[model samples]
Target chain A: MIVVGLLALILAFDVAHAGEIVALPNEEPSLVLQEPNECLQGNSYCAVRTSERRKFKWIEKSATLTMDWQTLLLRLEPGVFRLISGNLWVSPQKGQSEILTVETEAAQFSSRYEFWIRREESQILILSVRGPVEIRLRGDSQVYVLESGFQNWISRVDRRGRAQMGIPRAIDIESHIEVWARLFPGSRTEFRAALEEWRPIWLNAVGLSSEIHQELVHHRELAMAREHRSKKAQAEARASENQRLRELFRQKVLLE
Target chain B: MTRFVLFILCLTLALIEVRSYFHNYFSQSDRLRGEVGKLKERLARETLRRDLMAHQLDDFRQVVATLLPEALKPQRSNRADDYPLRNLATIVFEQKSLNLGLERAGVLFSKAKTHFQQGEYERSNRIFSSLIQNYPDTVHLAESYFLLAEGQFQAGDFEGSVRNLDAMITLFPESSLTGYGMLRLGKIFESQDRFEDAEVVYRTISKMFKDESMLVQEAQSRLKAVEL
Candidate 1:
């Protein structure tokens, strides 16, 4: 009995120390891994690291990483990343999470979400690839949970120099899936697998799909209406400008 | 004797009429020949002029090929007096050395752009910096500065990028890339949480580039975001 207990203790200790090493699903050409120390020294092209504190800055291109049990603090440039697992804290600038705070949880949790974070020119975009994600503006009490096929654009700066949380906007299923395929590589089968494995389950999540679909349709319609209005206004302004210019030219001709 | 005399007179009249007709026809033919000769001369002159223009265009294309070889490829219109050729002529006529300098700069810029596309930011930054330092008077000065700023921004050198962008704006206000530079500056400011500065830059872009519809729209969208 004593021997069995000792063996069990050793096994538990080993399990505790052993970190998860998730497979990096990358094709041969795109998989460039920097040396461990090089990554720590602030090389942007370095692979994602967790043993030491590192800042991963992506510029122009997109990268995807599969994490184990490690937690990473990502300092992003204008780029995109598709995180497979583990936890991530993303901020545009170093030590400035106040603008945007995005935290991802593992799939085991009831509210776990798998998502893609894109740092665009003016905003930080979060797209839920598989599950829902919890997003909050720094210093704000409100936590916005975004479901799959939904996106949010967090503005880096508002009029008051503070970051603002955007409303949850629904993205089309095809676009969401396209983003997944582009970032994660491989065929549709892999994407389906990832989605199936990480799909979130909220309490009383029934009939949520139709509601989300309706919201998406409504958002699309609103966007279309705004675009139409903008085009009409622009056309009217152009016409008025042309009329003014023509009048000025006519007056000059009359004076001549 | 009377009949013979009348026939002889008639024959003489007919011969005279035929002679006048022949004379008029020969004179008309001579004028037509003269016209044909003049036309042939004019055609030769035009063909020679076209050949000279084609040769000059080929030389200008060779210079452009040093920078971007793809630009020299045949395209629609194929006008000999295209903008690049015109610019080349002006530069070459002003100073032959300047044209040579532009060619060198183009080569360097192409290499730097390739590096940038390949994700080699450090090398790209270095080459772009060298091009700016060495070829300040090159036609690509404004674009090179912008690209250098982009490389610096990607390398996490925000301050350097801002300085380069400011320099580009100040030095090349008339450049086509000025609007894009202003837009990028606003984006950087937004990234740094400088809302007022970002708004100012976006507003400036909107005001300055009223004719650039796409750029104006982008600026307007960014302005709305800043307000929100």
Candidate 2:
């Protein structure tokens, strides 16, 4: 009986020490577990209400959280989250992680966008940031991917029942990072660090720095100005003849 | 011997238990240390990235400062003041009476046309110029302007011709002469090797005055020529 009791104690100790003890990196909790409820049988999901005014971040393992209206920064382990209505910014991390699926509504349009990042060949990270966000239009069975970037209109079903996507334009990544930084007051440093790393990459992809883009834009403006000047010169010469014709019509045609 | 074997087995089990306890504790500590090392490396990378960005920003600023001033250099004015006949028209307009009758304007326009036909372009130009200034309210104003521009073209004063032709179209947009004036402008542009301008004028005439079959044909031909 004593031997069995000692074995029970050892078994309890082993169970306690089996899993890796992952302490919260921050002294302050990364996420607030508001209105925590007991998980259902055979499921490890947390049920919590979200609001637009509230900010949330993921700092640990995979778990389901429902967001009604909130901004979430996924700077932790890759996990799936059901965002009923809100924006989420996922930062790229080192090493392979699970495929993150975010069911969220687009900011500008009232359409569902399923954003997912999956590993390709265990190395290449194929991030479908904007495009490949599976969108199924109302009354259509065919699903279409949102063309990359923030779009003005949602993909809609045509008369033939095929999904039609609008032209995709490049999104302003820096502005997005800035918005993310503003939302997370506590993780401002980390967000800014991510921004610092990603900004140059984005800029290089687009061509040059913002300053250089501005210069190129200015050159375009100058070309437009030159065209305007040419047109103006042509118009000025025509003004005198117009004045003459108007006066002629008044004095000769009208008066007579 | 069996008691000794049992004691040896117990001692081995106890030793294993002690070793496992220390191993678990040290492994946890090691894992934490690994995490800390990773964080430090990330921090260092972040610092280096920031420094690189700062350098790039500086380079961009330098490039902008160097190129912006030259790019934004003030374009020279192409006003009437740059022309020799700048004040001549103004002087004539100020000196002439504003109440000339339509008959008198008609006579003046005919005289200008006569001089232009006789190849006395300078004399025709002067008459046409005075007719415009004095009879700014005449019905023959568009005709007078067209004749003056023709005289200018004959005299190799292409700029002056362009000015007058443009004025004719602007002033009398509804007049049949405007279509002809646009065609002439296109020809002038073609002669000057300004094919784009010629093409634009031709396209404008062709598209805007589709009812004028002759003008459309002429513009289409010119457009094709310029495209070539």
Candidate 3:
């Protein structure tokens, strides 16, 4: 009985640790903060500052987003993923798109299916990965449509200053994709798996190419299995935690 | 004298072994106790961290919910702190989505029924599973699940049949076909020789659905059979 209890307690601890918030490492002052709206608390903006190495798992309703990126100040507005600056992966959890508008520093990307976006200091690069992406630059009135494997660049300011009007057509994204693949291997796997699943789907109304798709699927499957196992763990942790809090409150009540 | 010395030595050795065994046991117990204490501490820290994250997530979701178009916003409970009125836009979209789902489910249900009639139980089950998973809110939900279970029972999938029947009954308790579903479930239990279970189901049907004379009569007969 003691052994069983010890094992359960250990498992509970593991569960608690999994869900526990990791203090932002002192690598740099991290800022993942939220200020609630006065009208209705927490009915507004969400700020996240993630280091390059760590992935932040966020649950929005039933959908889950694991954000892994570099030098990003991302704001998740409703039906909109607003990137203030830096790179962001805009792929939905599954190949399924909630059709969220991907907005960056100088351009807005919208797609029927999926699109990926990135922003440098002054220029925003939009990658149309799978379906047709409609890109609207900050100042441009006309919407530029880009197909898969193509990218468009828009600058906030040119040498002369002011939002630079994008006169050039979108170019091929092969070189850019290669650079990104090397930079963000994990995200690359995700994009590839999604690409593989959807590519076949795209070709034959079938969908994924990239051999990397299998790896990504495997990774996701493992995570899912772990999550499934840990769901009970989480429940146990919550129960115990709530019990402890309840006891504390009761003690205070008794004192009064 | 030699035999006495040997017995004495044997007793001392046995005593020493027992002493060591207990020493090890107590040490193990102490270690485990220490581990449990550590585990509790870790759990406390973990819960606190998780709580912080949960708060942030809730805050973020709230903002997102506010920004969502009225049509897309989730249904709200009629609570004091919540807006009770359903948005007009939601009505339109909900109708559209629900209509689409109902249409799709209707098509699948029809297909499954045809398969069931044809004795193609496997094919029917495939369609039923798809329907149950995707179109749970289908208009013929109770019938769909019940028929699925009936088909499984015919196909010798007794466990599957029981599960589906249970789900159907539980999910659609107030459904018009619930009485029939209970009758079928009771019959299944009786066939499986689970007399007690069958009797319980029949009794429940007889008492719970008194308005349905035919159903009550059938359940009472089944209950008598199980009792016998």
Candidate 4:
């Protein structure tokens, strides 16, 4: 169970960073084990508060773990963030609830919203949302749902050169009804078209399906093989030519 | 019985270690979580401060634009011409609290001149035009017109250049640049093949400066070559 949880955390880290998953070199990343506690199976949640480098606090309750920590550091300013996983929901300090979801081939969780928080007095409150999961804030507490489809799926290019991938999560915003209705009429269509343009490049990079992509890979391989053979033949021909010239010179010398 | 005894002893040791580890781990994790929380707060405050500074800088630029003159006079810098004119304007841009009008005009003039040197003719022309429109009372009005003429020339708008040069010569007759302006007029007339009109301008320059400035000599040479 510990090993499985560690793997999931590593995968989550990969999604947050631009998909580089190797561990940092020459240093053992410190891992602190917490006592086993009941994990939230439904509507899992976590929150953190950071105060520029002086102190930090985290409270996490998920389908697999219930962990909380508070620590002090020299200073912390930019690039501090909070991440939570499992069928999650978020409630911001102000307007509509949100849900976030994460899906993978092995396991799937929906409505897993992540948020950052800042400390006020002794308590912390949400400041911003980072992941595509839904969020609900105060006043007009409608639940907004936004989730990423391909949060994690390690892909290796196959011999046939194709890979399947999912799309990023959608975002939900609620404004005055008139404004909202006016803005959303063609929003989905435009967004899908934009996604379609980027889909092929990403899919090929991850080794996914497409006849054109496969044909390109085949041509590249064939060209490489031909180049190798041509180079070898040129070397052999040069050797033969050199030997023949040497023999002819030897005969000419003997005749003289 | 012996195997069971050994197993019990191992279990005891494991329990002892596990309890102590969990106790220490939970305490340390709590401390770490608190630190991360504080860092987030600091980040928010710092970001807010930086954003406010940027907003203030933008506002300063707008105020400078509003107060600068319609025509800008160029100042020959004590610093070598190799230094960009815009750098001279930096002090004025940073002094927005002063509400001084002429200083801002100087900055705009410097910016226009820098743009012209960089081959951004359109931008330079617009800056010069703005100076002329905004600060007609400015002493640099005639200079602005002249600079605009130079911009038009660089952009292949010879007709526009002729109009602006004519305006500069008429508006600032007593201005120190009359000789230079007249010389430009001669060159323009020569380009149009109006050799007789060009000769009159060259003769006028010769009468104005008996010392015969280098520009007068060039104009005289061009006139003679045209006559031949």
Candidate 5:
């Protein structure tokens, strides 16, 4: 749930930043995260907002992470990312020896392999999809190691004003098939190919058979078509914005 | 008496004819011997030319062997299945080797440098590799190796960067760029948080070069930071 505050509108500058937009049909234009500048330092904090499109992207360079939307990210340290809301599916780049760190409202999640974290209602649900993940709850020094196919939850004491924590428990990974499809959606064929890299994890754990493989392909056409439409619209919007800027400049500067 | 004189003249004439025949045969034999000697010389020259051509062919084969891998090996399909229609949108190539231009090695080197400067590290590495593979004896070989390593580092290919840096240093120890290459290697070590390894590299660079005063100063400055 993205809250399009008045501050976002006020702080959103008219500068020509690439691939950024603030829009929705029923609500006010909700573009809050000011980004692409902070990530340039290579060792400092970088902030990014998930686009209003259907692209499940692996943010490249140092801290490469895969994600599905519904996120408002603010302040990312070298290894740590603070997810305000929505689910974040992160995996360290293949062969990279570094660990990835993600912080929620209550617990800090760190892992060398693939994991997912989502904030729902008053709790933060974390699912370790691939390897072991270390979860350190806020104000508690005890680090809980959650293995693969296990899920845990923590209370958002700061945000929701509720404190709840849960032990690691086994989860049905087959149930999360739709979730992975939605997140890494390009096509079933494509998704299956991408999953080859995580062969040891997904193939054995999920047991994705031919039937599930077919179901994954259903969302391909629609998502791609939607992505094309939105991207084209974004390009047009950027062009129109540029044109408007030129017109304003001509009227204001040249006329004056 | 007259009959005896005629018999004597006939005998002399016959003897003279025999002598002429023998002289003609001897002269012909000498001419044939001279021709055989000349033929032998021509044969020797042809054999030497053939041997030289064979040597040149061997050298050419050696040159091709360095560059043939890129041309022969198919590009890895990292995202071939990711987008089914991706081939229509992008260049799809397999089975065929990329263009090899040993003659245009200089032009390719400059292009690689431009790519590196523009921060297109992957593209830069590809071009540099082509140049290195095709033109092993290229004038820009040392720099190409250095830039290739540097580009790999930028592209987060730490292992490749290390291997390339080691190769460049080993191959071109006499080149002026070796000090800089070592310095970059030190930086790569530091990037991987191998602080002790980086300190050792810096120390080696500081100690190894007498004329490379600039590199020595840089290494010394870096040493202080790494020490801290």
Candidate 6:
């Protein structure tokens, strides 16, 4: 009886220990940063900054943009900024033909956000701060900017502003009665920064004078004035033509 | 010698019974313990997995904070390379499992867009026509039909534009671009000096896009033009 009791005890101990010895296969989780969603925020397209060697990925369901690293730049066209989250400031950069969309996602405390990045070439820059940024590339190699911060998102600038770039026609100051300067808010920082950076860079790289700066400003003003006058004249002409038609109709009815 | 033999037999019987009892008892306990250990390990692994996921989220947040500002800065211009449209289409198709219905419609629409951009009206028309014929149920069919109508209008094919516009309006009544389609139809009527028909479309858009400045302005302009 004692022998049997001792054996039973040993067997029970063995059973308990055996349960503790069994184990399962281990699985490690992934550590890669991937795009959060689809439907990228901002404009439909932005300039391709190929020199930056940036890769942008888009998630189709949620609009967001994810950047691989810093030195990647994207911009939005004018009148294309839709408020997604946080505070955004927009301004027209001097001597450029595009709008700048700047966003600060620092203040509002929220992890969920949407971003869209369309890769194209133009001056417009769209910036979305503090949101998941989606980057969509349709074809070809695309270049982008990855700003360093906790806030993420893509700001797009459409390519429609290409037509408004530098004038293709030769200008004759004599034929041009007035010149107006039209400043597009494409890159609020870059275009303005470029101008600020240009003088120093130009003097160092090529060389420039105060006279040249004045001349540049003068030409810009002339272009803006000319565009304004042309638009006004066209509107007036349309109105006048309408009035003429009205008078002619009145006269014909009376004569009849 | 007899006592020795009896003792041996009893010892053997005891050994067998003890072994059997131990096996039966411990076998069940061993299985139960194994299950318990498995549960414990699973709990530990899940905790680790959750922590890893949280860490990944934190890393993504850090990356976003660093990358967005850089994107807004002016970037250096890239060299122009010929974009392989065909290769891109293939890649997109492969990724989406080559949903043939969607792919063919996409091809037709792409062809139409390319032609339209290049100002090849007749070719665009042909492509859009084929799309409309093959995949009338395609989501892009509405857009294709709209493009066909626009192409016709630009090519001065007013009757053709009207026909396609009518089809777009009737077939895809729920399309978001249908408003623009309606606007185009109004413009077509205006061009033909059919003031009454133009007025109907303008008024409809005015009701649909209420408080939308651009559409409202367009409707107002068309209304004024028709009223005069």
Worst 10 residues of 3 chain A by lDDT: A32-41
- In candidate 5 the C-alpha lDDT for residue B13 amounts to 60
By TM-score, the best candidate is: 5
Cα deviation in Å at residue B169, candidate 1? Answer: 0.9
Each prediction's whole-model lDDT (CA): 0.57, 0.55, 0.60, 0.47, 0.65, 0.48
lDDT of 1 by residue, A124-234 (tens): 566665455666553244566777656667653222323466656555446555544544434678868865664443212324655766888999999999999999997
Predicted complexes: DockQ each: 0.01, 0.01, 0.00, 0.01, 0.00, 0.02
C-alpha root-mean-square deviation, each candidate: 41.3, 23.3, 32.8, 27.9, 43.9, 24.1
The predicted structure with the larger TM-score, 2 or 3, is: 3
Best by lDDT: 5
**A79-131 per-residue lDDT for model 4 (tens digits):** 12222211112222223323322222112223433332222242222212333
**Each prediction's TM-score versus the true structure:** 0.28, 0.27, 0.30, 0.27, 0.32, 0.27
Chain B TM, per prediction:
0.56, 0.55, 0.55, 0.53, 0.54, 0.54
* Candidate 6 chain A, run of 10 with poorest lDDT: A175-184
Q: Indicate whether candidate 5 or candidate 6 has the larger TM-score.
A: 5
Which of candidates 3 and 5 reaches a greater TM-score?
5
Write down the TM-score for model 2: 0.27
Q: Candidate 2 residues B1-228, lDDT tens each?
A: 788767766865796589687876877766776687668545644653454456346435434433433333336355766453333333333423344466688788878877876779999999999989988888778778877876787788999989998898888886656776787788889899999999999999888788767678878987998998
- lDDT at position A183, candidate 1: 46
lDDT of 6 by residue, A1-256 (tens): 6556756775676567654643433222222221221213534533221112233332222222333322122233333322222122222222222222322221111112322222223222232222222222212123233221111222222221101112111112221111101122235566556345423433332222345456788999999999999999978975674455334322322232
Q: Candidate 3's residue-wise lDDT over B116-188, tens digit each?
A: 7687989998899889899877666766786787778778898898898788777888753566667777777
What's the residue-level lDDT of B121 in candidate 4? Answer: 81
lDDT, candidate 3, residue A210? 37
Docking model 4 quality class: incorrect
Stretches off by above 4 angstroms in model 3 are A1-43, A57-66, A74-76, A157-162, A165-256, B1-228
Real contacts retained, model 4: 0.00
